[model samples]
Target: MGLRVSKGQSIAVRAFLSVLCLGVACFGAGCDGNDQSSEYIPENGAKIGASVADVMKDWLEDPDVPAAQRAVLERVAATGDMESLDYEQSWAQYRQCMTDLGYREIKLQKYPSGLYIEALHLAGTARQESKYEEDRAQCTAEHVEYVQAAYAMLAGNPNLYEDADEAVVDCLHRENLVAADYTASSFAEESARGEEDDYSFDIRDMKARSCLASNGHLTAFIGDDVEERLW
Candidate 1:
């Protein structure tokens, strides 16, 4: 699932391009090398579960909500669960949409988790980069945007800890990456100060980085070498 974060929501939804554009697996293989693209990747929990209506309120209630986003809201409303995306089906729809828009050489690979794009040389075109971006954005918005966002959030933090910051600290301590006595207060203070603040572990350490990214506290760009399938 390639979910891009929208700044409109205060939710910790990170950009999906971190996963999609770099050809990384949404969960299994981290997109540790992304452009930190404003979209693609998972979003998640804080213990306070989000209902379809709750998330929809981010855009649906707007008097000027775009027809496309409104459509996504309706689709999610029908499913009643964000994790309910039909990966194969949405990928098919998205593939055809991209092809129709002239990105015909598309190809996909299957991974243990889901389908992914092995080579979407979006850079293959000589067209203006801006134009390509516009088209790509349109296609994503219509088909995969919101569903993928919800999927990423749930996938990365399956427990859906409503307080993700606390969760990250917990994971660090659980993994023995930090002193057992480290507290959430320490985690918050440190996270607020960038990498210097340590609830017990160095945020930049490989294992620590993984814990932060996995818990939605930081972004880690993985090596481009990992295998993937795009759906």
Candidate 2:
């Protein structure tokens, strides 16, 4: 349950990473020569709610899951009422189920969109991590597939920023910011590695988003057309 953000109909998965990287590094005088503000955690309440609904849909239909549990999840899903939902309790049940199955070190972290489950080290045999991974894949295959497809589409398109205004790039340079040449392919690879290695923060930060916005890249990065395609 990694937290993701978006503006309007688009889930700014990459945007979330971009901003997160900035928030972590730029605030420390390491990149932007400015002190990082602890208060600047990116927020997109609308996106968070939408993302949870998306995940819940898959959870309810996950064939690998038990019917009883899915029924319980359906009730939980309805509790959102399109405004707010008890994410803590909803995720707690999942965590407890995993724990009952012998997965240790289960850590649940809150993100703007949803929760991220970190089953760091499992108990039992030497192949504990492998076993846990198998179970997780089986449980959340549909949700995982949807996310992978979205990221893959984003990664494949290299010219996503071509339409961005030149002023955006100029502003980034003027600010002395470090901007990565982001592409759909590069993002896909990075995203895959982040999951495989269990890298926290989803392999992105706030700097990227801040730099892009300062340079006027948001229009290109999060245009309505792009949102429709990604969502």
Candidate 3:
């Protein structure tokens, strides 16, 4: 996950909260409307819609496609709303692709929001988790690219502290809190550990918060007191 420092909130506090939320897997709880599909399609909607059409054209042309599904695709294309395409179909294809590639115990589940692939069984080993992430990335490459492009565009905005990210990294390095090239992957591993351990804040978290605060990246507050000051 990306670090989320607010305008006035210290980066240290934000890092603390980020770790806390990751530990509990509650970071996305309020993300009901934050679907990748709703991101602003920079450059008039046609480009992205066309990209989706190109990727799915072959699947749509298959004789096995249901008439109703075909109608939905046609409607989505006509309206340039690529998010309306059948995600269930794409998910099935992804699962099949992973299985064909020798992944076992791959399961998909539907929540109220959307489908999610569960590969925890595949995460038993570092190599297994790496392979699972790689294959899963391959399966969702097209969609991932589109969403990443949208986020990249958003990050390009000058108003959203685009430069601040680097500054925070620099601060962390100067304090010997993290490596110069510390990445989100580092935090992701920590988050996975937090989840497995039932969300307990640990020494690493304390050090991160302390580093941010000492570097003038955080404010003093405790527990819910910080929540009241949120932007």
Candidate 4:
């Protein structure tokens, strides 16, 4: 999955994350208190009760979806922007693409926190950190990770072979590797802190493995889950 960078906004990651947060909230609140028969309506506080796994499972079972769309969705599930599409024309184009692919009614929940996270990321990336060296360095490092991971996954797929820039490919590979190391270390630290249970530990490890397999490393841009934790 190539990350198309421009002067405007990036929506894929933000939208996916919004869905994840919404799904998590729904699952957490509804699992015990409410019945599954209770449809998750957007209003009346039902949408806020869906779980992350529930939403993810729905995406996995969607019949009309193709592998390419799923892969892209999965890649950005942690950070897809679902806020107002007013930044650029591409936001509309991407939304249209997803609708055409039949994911219009993908999630019946609304997670406002996802928008907050996206806004934070956009703000951080948008600002020139001339006064704060540490923040600037961290931001640069994070961007490198995101770009690298996307390219690494893209490179591993033969169907997405597009010849263009040698330098970009090399940079992506290098950053991907670095990201992997950092992710593994971070997981270990979190485990030590008892911040992860068996399921979460396994999920984190799987993410590390997935990134490693796709990019041969985990670049600084370690995807949405890890980034959310940072926030």
How do the residues 122-167 of candidate 3 rate in per-residue lDDT, one tens digit apiece? Answer: 1256776567657766755432222222222122221222233333
* lDDT by residue for model 2 (77-115), tens: 565322223334434555565566655434532222232
Which stretches in model 2 have alpha-carbon errors above 4 Å? 1-84, 112-114, 117-126, 138-231
1-231: candidate 4 lDDT, tens digit per residue: 222211111221222222112112000110111111211111112211133333333454555444444544354445432113322222233334433433321111112111111111222232222322344233322232223223332333212212111112222233232222222234334323432232122223333223223322222222433222111
Worst 10 residues of 3 by lDDT: 29-38
Best by TM-score: 1
Which stretches of candidate 3 lie above 4 Å from their native place? 1-77, 80-85, 115-119, 142-231
Clashes of 4: 30
Tens digit per residue, CA lDDT, model 1, 144-227: 555455544433434445555555555555445665445556666755554343234554445554445444332323343433
Distance from true position, residue 28, model 2, in Å? Answer: 14
Error of 1 at 162 (Å): 6.5
lDDT (0 to 1) per candidate: 0.47, 0.32, 0.35, 0.27
In angstroms, give how far residue 129 of model 2 lies from its true place: 2.2
Candidate 4 matches the true fold with a TM-score of 0.19
**By the lDDT metric, which is better: model 1 or model 4?**
1
State the RMSD for candidate 4.
Answer: 20.1
Q: Could you tell me every candidate's TM-score relative to the true structure?
A: 0.47, 0.33, 0.32, 0.19
**TM-score ranking, best first:** 1, 2, 3, 4
